[model samples]
Target: MAMDRELVTCTKGDGFWTRRILCTIRRLVRLSAKSSTVGNMAVLILSISCIDGNLLNAFYHAAPSSEIIRQSSMNSTISSVIFKDYDVTVMLFHSAYLVDIEQTEKGRVMKLDSLKNGDIWKTMDVLVFNSWLWWYRRGPKQPWDYLQYRSKIVKDMDRMFAYKMALRTWTRWVNSQVNATSTKIFFQGISPSHYNGSEWNEPGVTNCLREEQPVDGSTYPGGKPMAATVLRSALAPVRNKVQLLDITLLSQLRKDAHPSRYNGFKSMDCTHWCVPGLPDIWNQLLFASLFS
Candidate 1:
């Protein structure tokens, strides 16, 4: 069984595939168990298998404050479904940096040049990068003027530009990781928000997420056209090398899949999703894209 797992790890590319194979093996083992004791043994084996798997991957996930702070039902679901027990470190934030790249599966968040001679450029197996929801969450800045305020805390362009530059440098470094085959890169596309109060936009839906779930085919109105355009402008240069997961259109359609309705949150949240729902969808799409 250990040998088979090693082979699966090598051929299937580590974390995700190994977990899948182990899951199958566990179900089979459970079916063959003679008693409750055997079932417990099977469960232990399953846990150990996951712990020992050698799929070291990393996901540098970024999104706007709205997505993280508000906790989108879809986002939560996606994280739970796709990342459960996986050998992936999700550095989830609106922005961050790869300070020292030489730390070997453990790099600090310093300046970009600090990674100039580090080996993080070679050891990474997968790179999942993103940033967009932040801008949307904050709405838009004036053409010649910008404003950033967290209630009473307000920052100017210097801080915002520094944040953007740091993120860009981090992503550029991520793109430099070695072994393209061993490394599968992905980026989340723009997720259109529905705050405009337009007919299709569905105004006044404070926290749309709930457990009851709205229909799946309804779309949030009015954000994506410009949003995607801006996102494309930002990521287009790396598009060829990255698998852009455009989940916006489909996500918007799930009207009730927000924090309040679909997510675990009690209020009508607009950001995160229910773990079993949209996250599963994202993982399905992710797996298919990998194989197909």
Candidate 2:
């Protein structure tokens, strides 16, 4: 398989593409003829537990003191050989790096400048992360009713500004908490969505449904989205510490690769990709970077 031996799986959240990566890891190992597993990891610390939505009050409440976890090497969840007979073990803890929360007089609000969870970032060999979609969510799709920044809660703010704050909160932890010498970090660049046809130069197209052709050149006609600039700016502080897999441009050129209607599954899924298609290329890119 992908490891010199076996690969195990454990998770607290759903990442359909994350699962895909685990399945193809073995193939990547086979293709590269190389095994990338490092030494025995003490505990692949991922989690699925409860936390007070309000961090500002955490200091006053002793019940939430559990955040001061026994800083161990990490946490593990494998009972047997994950792959049965293989030689490597990989624990998938696909989690969204949660920002903090504050209880405001009006309601609960999400804090963008701080992280209330994610102390589970253990000393590991490799770390891969991708974010951005959640920042765009609004209405029922958005979880928090308000956003807290700089100690003030507001109904809303500039999304790009909020996005940068959240990212800074994450990157700051990476800069301080992680053992950079022993671990390698990778950030998958902004994965584009095909919700707007005008993004690909076809104004009336509206969606990826019935789309059959790739955008003709290396550069997409619609040009780079503003989110790309915001994302890069956020990662700039750790430019050397994190390797960004800048797939935005290339992905922007392939509007036809989205799941669209996905063979009658979701009527419209322009954000997600089709398996055995675009994600395969992402896997290849991941594999290449993993080995390189």
Top candidate on lDDT is: 2
- Each prediction's TM-score versus the true structure: 0.49, 0.69
What would the per-residue lDDT of candidate 1 be over residues 1-292, giving only the tens digit for each residue? 6544434433332334435433433343344422234332221100001111212111112211122211224433212113233222222221212232122232222343334522532333334444544432332532112232222212334533434544455456656753444445666665544333352544564434332444334554444555555555556666666677778778766655544543234444555543334544554555455443
**Tens-digit lDDT track of model 2 for 42-147:** 2222221111111101212221122222211244221111332222234344234347655767776888877645564544455666667677777886767888
Model 1 spans > 4 angstroms off: 1-122, 132-154, 158-167, 174-181, 192-205, 209-220, 223-227, 261-266
* CA lDDT of each prediction against the hidden true structure: 0.40, 0.58
When summed lDDT is taken over every stretch of 10 residues in candidate 1, the lowest stretch is: 43-52
Best by TM-score: 2
lDDT of 1: 0.40
Q: By how many angstroms RMSD does model 1 differ from the true structure?
A: 14.9
Q: Residue 51 CA error for candidate 1 (Å)?
A: 20
